[model samples]
Target: MELKNKDNNSNSGNKQINAMTEGNPVRLILVFAFPMLVGNVFQQLYNMVDSIVVGNYVGKIALAAVGTGFPLIFMMASLFIGLGIGATILIAQYVGAGDIENVKKTCQTIYTAMILGAIPISILGLFLCEPILNLINTPADTLPMAKQYMMIIFAGLLGAIGYNMNTGILQGFGDSKSSLLFLVIATGINIALDLLFVVVFGWGVAGVAIATIIAQAFSWIFGLVYMRKKYEVLNFQILKFYFNRDIFVKILKLGLPTGIQQMLFSIGIMSIQSLVNSYGSDFIAGFNAANKIDMFAFMPIQSFSNAVTTYTGQNIGAGRMDRVHSGTVAAVTMSVIVCLLALVIIPLGPPLLGLFNSDSAVIESGMIYLKNVMPLYVLLAIVFVINAVVRGAGESVVPMIGAIVTLWLGRIPSAYYIAYNFGKEYMFYSYGIGWFFWLMITGPYYLSGKWKTKSQKLIRQ
Candidate 1:
């Protein structure tokens, strides 16, 4: 298996994305993960800005109104997002093995699928918005604004979906830096527009939604142009769409389980959201703000986990199982170190929550959630990085099963039981409980070495 030096081809003028098959595992993983971490932070800002602007200008009800729509949006997008992850995994493997031809085919297949799928998703989402909100028992005071914000967002779903697909495609190439650039563009635009629409023009929730969609649209289109110009393999002709049946089948096999997992995860969050809603608008706003802050603690590990996936994929494709194992160790170690940041974040909870809204009830409610979940963040870090390694090895189903066991069987049910019997304040404990279960499931499977054999059939394809 003589490998090509294609990933570092200077003559090809496409060395923008580095190959992970060479270099020190720890250093390479760190270098790859850093840009992605920065990008993830900026990406999180889109929502953070929305929350900040809406909570300050339009009031608490409006803040809750915007916050209430997130789970539905994520739920709606989860399937496609899963497919994107599948595409990323495939691309990383192809990049690792220097399979440039198949990488192009994957790009074509997933892009065509997303474009065709976005149409029906947007229309169907519009019709389902109010009904789903009602089903979730969204607070009455927040319902109208939530519905308005969501419908507008659904109409612009293509922008968000497209930009994310772009990220996934680039990520598969092990090109985290370019994705960071695109996110920076989107985040800057979002912040500027958030101020303009929500505060300056006083458009409220609708304004924030509109700004997000517009920013996403711009970033997606800009990324497309950049990729077309920079990477020969990814120079997809937008109008000249091609759907490779074989590639589509392969992607479906890898993506469907992950898609189901993501959908269930979103459903689990939505379930907790409904419980939060029952406590009133202030609690909902608080939970939303706290959740945003939680992402900052989680972001570094999440970035490393994503890097682990690519690291594992490339090394597996290169038939370097030893490097894959070493990479996993490096990634887990990095993640644990990063998770200690939660200690700092927990003590600063009140100040952080105050960034969204000045209300004492909101801040107090947020503190309850941070205290419950932050200390146990290490459990999630281990689970996530380990599962990423498994998934990158083309073993998607195992991670999907872990998600099912964690979210559906563990977290959601535990949240409901505690909220009903004990109190809503105790419900956030369900997250740590779920992460423990996830670690329990993931750690054993990795130790068993079962995942190494899990996806050979797909890889051989």
Candidate 2:
């Protein structure tokens, strides 16, 4: 009847949804993933709408300014987001084990995270925004606009970090529904603010950035209230601002690799962005549009992957290896179906790309990127699910190593070489080739049975 026992039973392929307080893993996962997906879509929509509005109202240069700052912004925020991953896994394990004490301790760690992680990043982001833009080779014309936009976004780093931490806790506790609700609310507010500030008031990129930060702050505050009120285990008063060495080490052990992996991945994107910048603003705009579309196509797989991580962490904590296996099967199956759908639907890329731009040149370039990238969606789905499963099973090292090898050894270097030596057109091929290489490298990590052993060791230890 306990949460851990129920999780164990469910893992044995038992057909009971209500047995686990967390609910049926598949249904629970799907339901949880759906909102998260919607939220992700809306999050993308927030950016896409900004681009559409700016591209039409502000001009291509302003749009490019928004686009140029994305990698840099992501790179700055990656650490906290990566830390959230660590928090999620650890919190899920503790929640599954029904350890109220550790759960509260983990909640307190958020305070440490706020001070140690978010504040510093915010300061760094604000002070270095312009220099970073220059370093990334932002066009002289776009530099001022990019710096203006990024400065506003960075000034609100606390909101971003808070939302991430709050969402991480909710998801970790198997309450992903709340996380989704908060995101939707935030997204709605962001859109409204975007319209008011940009169109009505003529604020431009700064307007959109302010809207985003305000929404993020609202979501974080709302999520915090909910956690304190509903979850007895997460009451904020228990959140003493003290550093527990053991807790810190445990968090870093799991979180640091995932964080570094994300940071490295962002770096690779930034590297690619540098290549795109050389080609001109038209290419940059096209790349940004394609990136947004790709993110939409990728949403379901990402949602399901997060589901797998939570499902696997809880089940593994409860010593339900068989259930973990079954859950992985379900996740991978769902991911493959989504990927196939993407493969079928990607030919509409040109139309979708055109929605953001009226320019024939931008649409044409975007279509080329899609054609090269879409077929690999199927491969990426497998890679995503497998990687999630491994991480869920507490095998961070393999996934980290796989990510490093794939991005550095394959993606970034190939993108640089092809873009510089081969030609601009070869950039598309570089993207495809990098994904293919990722599939090759990461597949073995998933299949080696090493994750199972490592997970068992973690649980036993």
Worst 10 residues of 2 by lDDT: 10-19
- Residue pairs in candidate 2 whose N, alpha carbon or C atoms collide under 3 angstroms: 11-323
Q: What's the TM-score of every candidate structure?
A: 0.96, 0.92
lDDT of 1: 0.87
* Shift of residue 345 alpha carbon in model 2, Å: 4.5
Residue-by-residue lDDT tens digits, candidate 1, 296-331: 988999899889898888888877888888888898
Candidate 2 scores a C-alpha RMSD against the true structure in Å of: 3.9
Off by over 4 Å in 2: 1-25, 238-240, 456-461
**Per-residue C-alpha lDDT of model 2 across residues 1-461, encoded as one tens digit per residue:** 23333234322221111112344567767876887788788778877888887777787778788889887788888877777888887777766665556656776875576667777788888887787677777788888888998999999878878888888877777766777778888888988898899899999989888998999999888988877777655666524566666766666766778888888888888788887887778887887888888887799999999888888877777677777766777788888888777875467888888788878878877776787787777777888888888887777777788788888888788878877787777676766576677778778767777778766554343
Backbone clash total for model 2 is 1
The lDDT of each candidate is 0.87, 0.76
